[model samples]
Target chain A: MYGESKSGMQCAEFDLLMTDAIDGLLTGDQLSRFEQHKTACPTCSAMFAEAEAGLHWLGQLEEVDPPVNLARNIVLATSGLANEGARASLRSVVNTTPGRPLWDRMRDAFSPRTIWDHVRGTARAIFSPMATPRFAMSAGMAFFSLSMVFTVSGVKISDLRNLDLTPRNLTRTYYATEARAVKYYENIRLVYEIESRVRELRRAASTSSVEPEQENKQKNKQDQKSPKENEQRQYQNFSRQDSASVVIATFDPGESVIGESARQRRKL
Target chain B: MEDAQVVELLVRRCIAGDAAAWEEIVQRFNRRIYNICYRFAGSPTDAEDLTQDVFIKVYRTMASYDGERASFNTWITTVTRNLLVDHFRKTKNDRITDSIDAAPGESEDALPLSDRLEDTGPAPDAHLERRETRELVQAALQKLSPELREAVILRDLQDMDYKEIAQALRVPEGTVKSRINRGRAELARLLQRTYRQVM
Candidate 1:
């Protein structure tokens, strides 16, 4: 019942009136109206009471002593006086020199790192474009080279004059005859070496008198027989090598044939 | 020197990078700044740190000072209030409790009568029952929202006018009034609760 007018005074409006009352700003008719509203509203009355208490409490908050060294520390931090040792050192150096320029004094006050930062900023601003130009030029050349390679390789310019017969049938004939010739020559060479080695071992076994020597000669003939066995192994290895080489050569021939066809188209 | 003369001298010395002038300035204002910080933060240690930070900020920004705009005290108080508000926003849950301990061996009854009188009339304690009631009132104040508390502190404790309080708080005078009223109401409820608890 006491706060019935609370709905009439919007919260914001009530708060404003309350503030005005605290500040002694409300007067005449406005003051009378607020008093009437407060007498009827428990909420507004409570707010006024709270405001009074808060003010009283704020007044009672005692001023505490600041830390003893607070002023000293603040002065040290703000005035750059903390670097007295560095300053003293610089002063001694300046004293040794009879007279120094104003710029030198200024430089002495600034730390090397600060100067370096300024120099680095200036250098970046002045030379940044020059530093990247080489890389930019290289990139441009690479792009140009790529485009030229693609254009030359992509365009089909062929001559009819360079076109030979298909020659696919002729390739098989030539490969077979070449392979037979190589195999025949290799076999004849291997047979000749084996027959000569057998004759040498038979003569050595017949001439030796001691049994140990004869046994040695027999071991020699057995060792000599290993060569003929190795020749057979070599023949097998050669056959594998020859087949691989033939496939590679055939692939190469096919590539050349494509190139020849391209030339022939251009001629035509 | 008068406060204005002192501020002018300190400002000149500070601009000239005089270390001693800066120290004197800190010593003069530290207590007032700390109290403001304490009222805002409700913690002694936080208040002390904040007071130091306020001084540091004042020193750094002294170059921006123009005497025509405001007095040095008003500028500093404004800075302290703004910093505290920013701090309050960051730590939304931090409530500033009035933790003023009673001075050792001090009793209300033993005190002189003149000490208890306000300019208006009998002191606040004349109507209240006991010294403990003051404590209860303080505790209730801690329960008020920050906006309300700030308004009350600025208007009542700091004795800033409504317009000045509004300006310091960067709010309309109407908004300031509303916050103060609501803050007062909340505090009264809290005090009532405390009174009941004590009973």
Candidate 2:
């Protein structure tokens, strides 16, 4: 691919020089050198001929018309993009435009009524005393008065010397005397004895009633032939006992004794 | 309108966001820009797309235009050349192929020489021969490298002088002349080959 070189122009340089020669751009010394090289070099000569022929041929090509819609399409596309930009810009302008008057802004800054109201509110908040302590004192007084009324209504003072004394009455009188005296003393001994006796009686009653109630429930269950029926019978017995206990607790002593005798007869 | 006046008005309206003026600008240069793009892309469709792209680029960068440096035509041509070179680099997979055809709307009697003759008309055979010669020239022009192609298109097709071509291409005048010469020689060889093939 090497060609004749002249005046420091190699093959590639020679080609460039030959192009320059064809284009009539080479200067005095370069022009003479290029001409000498072309005269001696067949490749440079051919290249020059080819370059001329090519330029001549290029001069002949017809300039074709583009598509008819080309300009219209471009305009449409660019217009669409531009219109969108314009709309965005317009929106920004509208958003940024001042909506309020200068007087309105000034009035808002220095309104006298609002300043006075704020000052009044601050003064009230700083100086005003809370009513919670006074309300609490009133409530305490009402509570103390209610308690005094209840205590005075519930208490009665009888003559202390009228308590009775015969052998059976002496035993009752002694118990009454002991009961009155017991209120004055610590009386741990009597209270302990009463508690122990009540506990013993409760244990005995529970032990005696549990077996009978269970036996009755079992018998009722056997008669009914179902556990649910036995449970219902047990619940009925418990309800009867609960009602009787309530009646006994609510009755006067004389009525209670009579009711107990009647209950004992019924049991018998 | 005078070219300078039209350019000035269009530039003013374009800056003012006048779409109609922008469209007139596009219409005015569409053919010329398309021709430049066609010379680079060697396909009408690609050329059309590239021309549209060039105008879009021009519109975007118009704000940066400093009128002191270059004429509008030279600026646009430079934009087109740079865009085409970028397109060539991006789409290296598809080679550009040029096919010769008659200019659109140009009849047989409307050949360049015939038009120059001032006879108002010419014989059909002369026009056809002129068209054939034009096609041969175009086929030859397609054989050049991008730089040489740019030089030839600017010099011969666009009918710009070496100085203008050099200014458009940002090259020395001597370099532009050398490129044109090399490009023309390559184009001649291509034309001969094509002629031989046709024969």
Candidate 3:
């Protein structure tokens, strides 16, 4: 489709090179090839004509004069040395009034404080969008949730002020934190082990009582089988019992052996 | 010192907490940036607000400007282009298509479209024609896609060189030229369709 024309340039090539030609970047053979292609192809010629006309019209679209107060407004907004907004009267006073006292101008316009204000104003503007109600609400909710979590864990704001700062005390505090974490983990592990043992005991007592009649019938049946077959049946029965115990464990009540231990200690 | 040096000195003063230098910077670029915004947004009001926003951003990020990497012009233009793109993204949903019936520019200097239509008195003098042409071209420009619109605006309207435009637009020089070419062709066809007599 992009086969070369008599001008040694394809239409697609002409289209690609047209921008350079319009920009006057093409010279020598490139320029000649482009011109020859444009002359030969009506479509490319029309396109080139349109682009030229467009560039000319655009060139005539002279730059518009900014609003009179635009500069004043920008200065007021950026500088923060004065009130912002299009307060034309104030802007005129700040912008047009000539012969302000040198000291006054220096203090108002050149002072480091004004620069600080400018910096502050810019920073504020950049962050203004982030100060939306939704963001504020989200932040407040986060803070409230954090405070609630801290309160539930027995952490107090006041406790932060009473912390010891000496190096010796700091080392002791670090070790204390480590010891407390280890103790908490160990307590959790002990509770888990106790819960599992109590669950196994409960399951053993319930199965022994509820299925004694079935077990007796199985024992009578096992007496008629070969010894090897009887042994396999026994192993299968043990495996089924272990699976039943696991199923019961999943439905175990929230009450743990820890509560029973406290009860026993009270009785003691 | 050259203009670039002067701008560099001004930027140094600005970075050093010179309020006067900041004001000077704003004054120098306000019209240029305002015009760019006006052409890009197709609204004088939005342009004014955008110009203020651009200057605010420039003030905030002045410390980051590097004269060694780009001239002040290119740097400021890049800043303006970025803000305009951001503005475009934000207002993409809210943008209403511009009808030729709507007033063009809506600034003090620009005559309303209705006023131009009613100017039955003598085939509008050169000043009026030029103003009408400006408004027509602006309206035509609003019809271009943002990519093409920005390319043409930076090249033909702002008169930035292609290299500076490439830097500001963060595109290859060839891509920039291609966009400008397409933008010009589209704009010309649009103007020819609408204001054939004027063109």
Candidate 4:
């Protein structure tokens, strides 16, 4: 966009002029020249337009409110410093008040050894244990769980290395992809079972063909079966995206192996 | 109170451990100082800490004030500028930028300065666009060099004239004006680029 102009003004010069114009720093002569150049040059016009647009946006910046309690916290900190200053001044006055010789006072005030000794004393006092910890009776009793008495055998390094070290959350990746395949095959199995049930009902219906009411009774009983009800609940949970998968996942936590209910048709 | 009288009164009382005077002093200049810090730090998160540090430094060095010379506002701003420059120097590795510093034409991946702005309350979509404009301008300000950034902020945001900015920044008026102009142009370029991406 930095093209030269017939008015002897460079685009870069026009860029600076754009700001000068906005800031009202340009003289009448310069402003007139800029106008002539802007009208004559595409690059200068585009640059002027861009700068104007940017300045327009910048002008819209609102004054941000300071965070809540900033003033209070600053005052509190300032007060702490003031208090410390007052005490220091009082100490200095006491040191310099005609009680001691000038050299001796200076020694006390600026002596490195004295300052180090004071620092050491403060450090020792701070780090010294003030009291031995004593637990309340209730806390002691609560800590004594029966489970604590039953210890498991210690795991050797080799034993631990033999087992999977990945976290359960990481193992979830394995379950996600594998679960779909398990569901697909289980659906096929369920479809086959339904077909078989229908065939059996047909055969029975042929025998009971004399009474249509008997066939209806068998259909109603099949609808109320636990597996059918369980499937319906599972379908609803899947559609709503509830934690039914998590519940199924926790049924066997040793691994993230899932869809066992699907394969076995368990009434979960 | 006049600037000198206020400084003298507050300084005396604060030295004597008057919490009230300190509170008043903080309340008076806190917003101005915060705005400066916000501009310099280029983000809200660092502004509060930077402002607190400036105040603490002011308190610690309270013994060095001379109310007979420069006004308190001048002195405090000088202190702030010194601290801010030092801070920027020390944290040279810690780049203060919005997503604009990414590779060219990668605007899709780069989040606009607007997305990073907090405290934009439940406003209409129009208000949100204005806020975005504000943030993009600030992001553009971040693109300038420190000298230019300081000059532009002092000139535009702080509304300091050429002479005052020159005095504050300890530079020639010509240099200050040059920096301000160049800074404005760069800011405009960045703001314009981002505006198109945003729209």
Best by lDDT: 3
User: lDDT, candidate 1, residue A240?
Assistant: 82
Give per-model TM-scores: 0.47, 0.48, 0.57, 0.50
Best by TM-score: 3
The order by descending TM-score is: 3, 4, 2, 1
Please, what is the whole-model Cα lDDT of each candidate in the order they appear?
Answer: 0.63, 0.69, 0.78, 0.68
Question: DockQ of each model against the real complex?
Answer: 0.24, 0.26, 0.31, 0.20
Q: Which parts of model 3 are misplaced by more than 4 Å?
A: A1-6, A10-16, A23-25, A81-268, B106-122, B196-199
Please write out the lDDT profile of model 1 over residues B1-199, one tens digit for every residue: 6888888778666555466776788778876777667655655667767877787778766656555667677778788888887887877755423332222112323332222322246455544434434444444454566788788767655677777777777888777776766665566566555445433
lDDT of 3 by residue, A83-173 (tens): 2221222222342234677667666665565555556666765676578898899889999999999999999999989988999999999
Q: lDDT at B98 for candidate 1?
A: 39
Q: Give each candidate's fraction of reference contacts reproduced.
A: 0.53, 0.64, 0.67, 0.35
Model 2 agreement with the true structure over A1-268: per-residue lDDT tens digits: 3555655566666765655465578899777777777666777777777777676566567677887998897787676446434433322232233555766655643467434544654555444433358867887999888878867888323432554544898788779899888775757777888999999999999999899899999998787777777788998997788667657755766556656656655664
Across residues A1-268, which tens digit of lDDT does each residue of candidate 1 receive? 4324553454445556766676688898778777777776776676677667655555554445666776666666655432333323323343233356766656654757445544654565555656687978988999888879867878433653555556885687789899999999999999999999999999887777566787999999999999999999999997686555545545664566556545544554
Give interface RMSD, every candidate, in order. 6.9, 4.8, 7.5, 4.7
* Cα misplacement distance, residue B55 of candidate 2 (Å): 1.4
Q: Which ten residues in a row have the lowest lDDT in candidate 4 chain A?
A: A126-135
Give Cα distance to truth, residue A141, candidate 1, Å: 46
* Cα deviation of B108, candidate 4, in Å: 17
Candidate 3 structure, TM-score to reference? 0.57
For model 1 chain A, the run of ten residues with the poorest summed lDDT: A81-90
